[model samples]
Target: MKKNMGNADRIIRVIIAAIIAALYYTNVITGTLGIVLLVLAGVFVLTSLISFCPLYAPFGIKTCPMKKG
Candidate 1:
């Protein structure tokens, strides 16, 4: 798939995922909510790494800047 996420979007996702991981590891988050968030964080990292977001596909959303002709 073409990259749908812009640099800023990808960076933000990575940062958020890292924060979630830190919170979980540091015991700042626990229980079911924490588990769920951690899982979501994993997804965020994966997507950010790939610069693709499946959810954005269906909506035809693209954060990437337009390429100059």
Candidate 2:
């Protein structure tokens, strides 16, 4: 798959995932909602690392800049 995420997008996702993880670990978030967020956080990290978002593919959205020929 092509990279559809730019540096800013990747950074933001990583930050969000880190926040979610911190909240869960600190007990600031708990139960079902915490679990759900934790899972979403994992997805965020995965997508950021891979630089691709499956959801964005169908919509034709791309945050990555075009390469010069």
Best model number under lDDT: 2
Clashing residue pairs in all predictions, respectively, total 0, 0
In model 1, where is the ten-residue run with the lowest total lDDT? Answer: 9-18
What are the models' TM-scores? Answer: 0.94, 0.97
> How much lDDT does each candidate structure score?
0.97, 0.99
Give per-residue CA lDDT, model 2, range 1-69, as digits (tens).
999999999999999999999999999999999999999999999999999999999999999999999
Task: Write candidate 1's Cα lDDT for 1-69 as tens digits.
Answer: 999999999999999999999999999999999999999999999999999999999999999999999
Candidate whose TM-score is highest: 2
Considering only N, C-alpha and C atoms within 3 Å, which residue pairs clash in candidate 2?
Answer: none
User: Model 2: how far is 17 from its true place, Å?
Assistant: 0.3
